[model samples]
Target: MARWEPHARQRLADAALELFAERGYEETTVLDIARRAGLAKSTFFRHFQDKRGVLFAEDAPAGPLVAAIAAAPAQAGPLDAVEYGLDALGRDVFTADRRPFTLRRRAVIEAHPDLREREALKEAGLTAAMGRAIAGRGVPGLAARVTAELGGLALKAAYERWSDPAGTEDFGDIARQTLDEIRSAVAEVRG
Candidate 1:
């Protein structure tokens, strides 16, 4: 058996996505993913808990996001902090090179009910984390929660636009634009 190698986690994820696309998520197995990645099955287990985990491995977005929010200027509003955090994500996690993989992964998740449910749970968890991060910055709890939800909505909408095959805009740019659009729509609704 080949020992674990560097980039094992990424390899496993890539392999899993390829297999899920080709064979369908329900038909793919952890072992098959391992084999396709040219890594040992143990390597897969070390990186992910199970088949479902392969797709969700990179879902942990709280650290960079929270840190960015915390690092924002002291006078920044909740939404401004969210924009800072999302910009950080764009710089660190959702760079241009990651676009192809992200698009593929999104398609795979959308095609399956189980994966879609998991994606929703991940989104909720991320939103809650963002709320806590914003609240920690001295924003009111309700306001922080609202900002986080708005940020989540912007993130989703931005991702949809950013993942388009013809889209060349940076993730941060799209996110900022989407958030602004949402903000405008909210104001109109209230007026």
Candidate 2:
């Protein structure tokens, strides 16, 4: 019988991301992903419910950003937590052993307008949740929302850098650098 273990699920994610890049999302099928992962069709079903689930797998670091933000130091300002939460994803998945594959995933999404919108929607949800979390920590809603949106913007810029094959900086480093730039810009505006 096909299993629904983490390794099997990861295999499904890898296969799905790879095939989505190579064959295009609409052109690819769950069977193709299962075959690429060296698993059975039932194995794929055992993990993800459908082809799209492969894209929105619960295990991706993107899904953890809110939790990380919520768990950061209570004294940490909203923006600081936002930066920390986003930075937490750098070496684990988005920029880890799967960096190249992650880039491919990004490229494919870039080509599909609907996918791009979906991505934006996903980010917005994360941002809204983060904003609410920050507000709960005593940050004003407006400031918390700005912090969340700024974090999302930083994520976008960092992903762009990460997806560029010619870009050599580590994703975490790039994110920190971008955060520094944002800080400087904010300080300049306030001064």
Find the candidate with the highest TM-score and give its number: 1
Q: Residue 13 deviation, candidate 1, in Å? A: 1.3
The 0-to-1 C-alpha lDDT of every candidate, in the order given, reads 0.88, 0.76
In the range 25-139, model 1's lDDT, one tens digit per residue, is: 9999999999999988888898899998877876567788889998999999899999999999899888998898888899999999988998898888888989999999998
Model 1: lowest-lDDT 10 consecutive positions = 1-10
For residues 133-172, what per-residue lDDT tens digits would candidate 2 score against the true structure?
6776788868887887788787777878776888877788
Q: Candidate 1: RMSD over Cα atoms?
A: 1.5
Per-prediction TM-score to the true structure, in the order listed? 0.93, 0.81
Positional deviation of residue 128's Cα in model 1 after best superposition, in angstroms: 1.0
In candidate 1, stretches whose alpha carbon ends up further than 4 angstroms from where it belongs are 1-4
Which candidate has the top score in lDDT? 1
